[model samples]
Target: MHILLHDFAGHPFQAELSRVLARRGHRVTHAWFAGDTGPKGRMARTEGDADTLAFLPAGQDLRYSKTDFLRRRAGDIAYGQELGQAICAMKPDVVISGNTPTEAQEGIQRACRQTGTPFIYWCQDFYSVAASRLLARKLPGPGHLIGGYYRFLERRQMRRASRVLHITESFRAQTDAWGIPRERVSVIPNWGALDEIGVLDRNTAWAQANGLGPGTRFLYSGTLAMKHNPELLAGLARAVTAGDQVVLVSAGVGADGLAARAADGTLPGMRVLPLQPFEVFPQVLASGDILLAVIEREAGTFSVPSKILSYLCAGRPIVLAAPGDNLAAQILRETGAGQVVEPEDTEGFAAAAQAFRDDPAARQAAGAAGRAYAEAHFDLERVADKFETLFSEARNGL
Candidate 1:
């Protein structure tokens, strides 16, 4: 079958799945938004890749501003149109799309309908719900109404889809509320690139070149969005003792602000760097003494930080600042991967980071547990089997 996989963020594991499917004697085209500035995967086609595999750009190189709703919405629509044209032209047997704006998803659904292709809604997050909250805050009076329109569009598109794959079971509530048939939705938790993200030595060339390691380093490598609580990150930096460095390898408005502050001496003892190339991602993760992640209290279970999964693969103990009920926090609790502190408790978060920093034995134990969990759960072969089954079902009019 000709399969088109559109992952808006161009994440690592999703691209790994595409490679697996391609090697299985299927024609697979992995597509993503090249303009996106966050962590990306092995986007370039390597020489060892099967001839059946192809990587294509589906979104334009327009200025991507998350805070500017009007401009972002226009970019979304333009991307949708471009992706739709590709879908129509390729006329693939199956299309799986996720991490997309609702407006762009609508266009993908439309194109699938036009081409009579089976469209799978890869529901990574409740984009409508997040957007609704964002719009409500941005346009207090009528923001809700505008947000409702997006919710309606999202529900309609999911309802129209042949199958819907959710990244977390928390999405079950929304799908049930959407009145989508119970059989149409399935939960396939996201995984890390087990083969890609290996555990490298802390003193990797990348780490040494960046002057990161040989000392206690609390590292964060991901999208540091507004909802991620930048102040807590700053608090973590401030609370760290002198000679300890907080390194942020990230992007997003919040991260940019933190970087600016760090540069201006307002936020000290922090080294902020842009997102690094995928080739050096393993070294980037390994350079840290302790991995760090954060989520606001208001976020609850609405989002799962994919960084946590990747961190597990990196065999690093994580210090996550999130609510107890948040899935990532729960994973840490279950796996004994690292420490978890309430998102709002700056003191607790800082203390946890310091504890991990001062105790190498504790860090080693926690890191071992996380790597064991990753090895047990992040089975690419098993994951591929399920997706292959879904592809067959979707192609046969599921």
Candidate 2:
């Protein structure tokens, strides 16, 4: 079967799935929005990749401004049109899309319907919900109305999708509200890219380059968008045990805010750097004694922050600031992989950091637990089998 898998943010594990499907004798073309300045995994064909596997970088030259609503909307429309063209050209049996804007998703699904192809709505997060909150903040008066239109489009897309693949079971409450059938949706949680990321110690060359480590480095390595609070990051920097520093690898609005604070001496000497290349990501991750992730309370449900999963693969203890009910937080609590504090709990977040830094044995244990979780969850063979089954079901007109 020919498959088109489009993860707009160009995430790591999604691309890995494309490789696995191709190895299973199905042709898979993994596509992504190359212009997004987010942490990406191996999107290119490796020497070991099968000929059936390929990569397509959609909108490699498009201008994407995360903070500008109108500009982003326009970019989404353009990307959607380009992706629709790819759909017609590839003529794949089924297409799976995630990390896509509502407008783009609507367009892609319409293209699938027009071409008589099955479309899988990979529900990584609720884009319409996020857009609504962000838009409301940006445009006070007509924001809800604008968000309502996108929500309408999203509902239609959901109702028309061939199948909805969700990353978490909690999404059923929302989809069920849309009156989608129980069988039409499936929950397959996201996993870390264990195949590509190897375990590295903290004394690597990456730490040397950064002039940071061999000591405790708490790394927050993901999208620090509107849903994230830069103040919490600043609080983290101040809260960590002295001699330990916090690293923020991000871009866009949050990056700007953090950089400003760092410059003004308000951020307490935290390292605010732009997103690094994926080639050094493993070492970058390794430089951290405790990995970090943050999401605001408003974005607790709408944002999953897959960086938590990536941190798990790094064999590092995590210090996450999010809602207790958030899936990532729940996982950390259940697995003892790391510590989770409330998004607004600056003191607790700091305490968690200090505790981890002070106790090497406990940190090592948490890191071990995290790696164990990654190993158990990311069996590529089993994962590919599930995708293949879904594709076959879609082909059978299920």
- Per lDDT, the best of the predicted structures is 1
**Tens-digit per-residue lDDT, 66-148, candidate 2:** 77777988889888988999898879999999999998887788789889999999999888887787778878879989989
Pick the TM-score winner.
Answer: 1
The candidate 2 region of ten consecutive residues with least summed lDDT is: 207-216
Count of steric clashes across candidates, in order:
0, 0
lDDT of 2 at 125: 87
Score every model by TM-score. Answer: 0.97, 0.96
Per-residue error (Å), model 2, residue 128: 0.9
Model 2 misplacement above 4 A: none
Candidate 1 lDDT at 296 equals: 73
lDDT of 1 by residue, 349-395 (tens): 88999999888899999999999999999999899899998888888
Angstrom error of the Cα, residue 332, model 1: value is: 0.9
Relative to the true structure, how large is the alpha-carbon lDDT of every model? 0.89, 0.86
